[model samples]
Target: MHVLVLGAAAGGGFPQWNCNCPNCHRARRGSVHHWPRTQSSIALSADGKRWLLCNASPDIRAQLHANPALWPSELRGSGIHGVLLVDAQIDHVTGLLSLREGCPLDVWCTPNVHSDLTSGFPLFPMLDHWGGLRWQPIELSDERTVTEFAIPFLTDISLTAFALHSNAPPYSPRRGTPSCGDNLGLFIVNRQTGQSLCYAPGLGQPTPLAMRFLAAADVVMVDGTLWTDDEMQTLGVGSATGQQMGHLALDGPNGMMALLDPLPKRTRRIVTHINNTNPILDDQSQAASALKAARIDIAYDGMQLTL
Candidate 1:
């Protein structure tokens, strides 16, 4: 299994155009210690030729440009074989609009996510505009369901979607609707290699089932939205704590640091969907050192790993 980190920063991305927070400030200045990243998204390939994108980030064009192997000149209008969405967030699904010009694509997502995509963005009308495009909705269940799927040019792969708790409050059906189910996570296994990847980007809190999946995986790319609960408040950036923002805080007792400490050393763990305010964005910062000591990688935009 070859995994490519398309865009590793959280929602607004590092050095978010309008923000002047410390981390963003340093990133704009091109400080060696501060690395710039794009919004969160990834691609997985069973063989190097064909790939399946995990999420279609708003930065899809640039991400594809950065990784030419995935979108060579001859494959430009052909499009990827499939796209799997992790949530209904704007950053994750908005990029689907860009795919309209390419070959009709296959989109695999939860029913909730599909609903969100279909109803939320009237401007895109992706589902209706692209005749060749298809939406394959995966109904998440408490018990895992395994199925075989193919990513063009790659080996057949096994996919599993499991129900997990949503950190966000329920969206009012009366007011408006949500595009994706509030609860979701994905476990993708490569049938040929027996290697697997567990991805949960908008993780609220770790549940027993989530932990079990994390424990069993060879590579775990979980959320790393904030370094501390009071991060935004302390920095005068926002009123909510990290938890209140719907992501796991990395510091303090029972935080990400504590929860991830017990995982077997062999398992490769990485933190993606990182926030702009997180000090770990500054490689020389203590937070970065702490995470490195724990063997947790802070994701970067062009990072790639072969399992």
Candidate 2:
């Protein structure tokens, strides 16, 4: 299986249009320490010819254009064969609008996430007007037995999805009422090579269940949303902490770094879905340097992994 980092930044993406955060400022001025990224999303391909997009970020159009591997091969055909969604957040789901053209896409997500999109956001219903949006519902595991799924075209790739602790979308009826399928993390395995990968862009905590999934993967790509829990508050960006927003901060004793530092040395750890306010965007910052010292990578657009 092949994994491609189509976008690495969190919601508003690096160098968000309106804000003048230090990181964004430096990027706007062409700082070498910075490389602008699209919103979070990735594409997985077993054959390198057809891909299964993870999330449809608002920036999917530009992201696809930037990666030649995803470019269309025929007059009206595209390399993307299907889509898999991990949650119902705006940054992750809105790109379906841009993708409504051409053939209908086979979209996979938990039933609750599908409900949120169909009722709360109504993106699913809107897309249906043009026809061809196939909903593939998935379920969380009871833990006694593992649950897994596969994209027919990507036959060699199998994915095991486990519940992740995250808040439901504000517009969702289940908001503030945690449920099993609100969010999820995927453990992708290459059946042919026995290589595995874990992808979770939103993680509120390092729950035992999450750690189990992480322990089994050769590569771990997860949230790097905030430098500190208080980043947004201190930057005057917002009052909500990373925890409140269902993201794991990168600092603090209980932060992401602490959560991942003890993983097996051979695992390839990567940071993605990073908030623009995070100082790690500056390669020279202590935050970025810390990641470097640990041999953890900061994901960038177009980064690829062949498993």
Candidate 3:
């Protein structure tokens, strides 16, 4: 399985156009230590000809341009076989609009995420006027049973949706009940190779279920939203800590470091969906040193890993 990192930054991306935070400032100035990134997304290929996109990030156009493998000669109309959405967030699904009109793209997503897209945005209606799109809903259960779905041209891949704790509180509007639903972390395993990849971007912390998935993965690309809980707050970039923003803090107990320490040596761990404020983007930063020492990689745009 060949996996390509399309964009590694979290929502808003590194060096967000309007923000004047120190990290953004340094990125704009072209400082070597601070690497600029786009929104989070990834592409996976079994034969390296046909591709399956993990998420249709807002930066999909640029991401496709950077890696032509995603745009195969077989591309007609919309230009890809299918897209797998991890959640219903704007950053993940908004880029579906960029697909070519009149081309029906197969979009695989959970029921809640599909509902959110079909109702939350008017763009779906507008896009339908051009040409209707097909949605394949994947029903998720708390049990870690492997669900298999076939990608056109490519072989079937086993996907397991693991339940995760939402960052939002029970009273929070974002926290929908069982009838509506919460976000999910996806575990995709290539049937041909038996190699699996785990992705969980918007998570409050690593659940035992998540760890179980990670333990079985050949390549694990977990969220690296913030170095510390108060990283953004201390930097005066945001009022809420990283944990409060729906992601795990990278340090301290129940953090990324502690979770990763016990991971099997064969499991290749890489951090993705990184926030701009996180100093892990800086190679010289102590945070970066710690990650490297533990054999965990900080994902960057255009980075590719073969599992």
Q: TM-score: which candidate is best? A: 2
Best by lDDT: 2
Runs with alpha carbons beyond 4 Å of true place in candidate 1: 75-79, 123-127, 130-132, 141-154, 167-180
Q: Which candidate do you rate higher for lDDT, 2 or 3? A: 2
State the C-alpha lDDT per candidate. 0.76, 0.90, 0.76
Show model 2 residue runs off by greater than 4 Å. none
The Cα error of candidate 2 at residue 131, in Å, is 1.1
Clashing pairs in model 3?
none
lDDT of 1 by residue, 105-140 (tens): 788776666555556544235446665457777766
- The C-alpha local distance difference test score for the whole of candidate 1 amounts to 0.76
Q: Candidate 2's residue-wise lDDT over 140-215, tens digit each? A: 7656878888889998888999999988887889878868889999999999999999998888787888899898
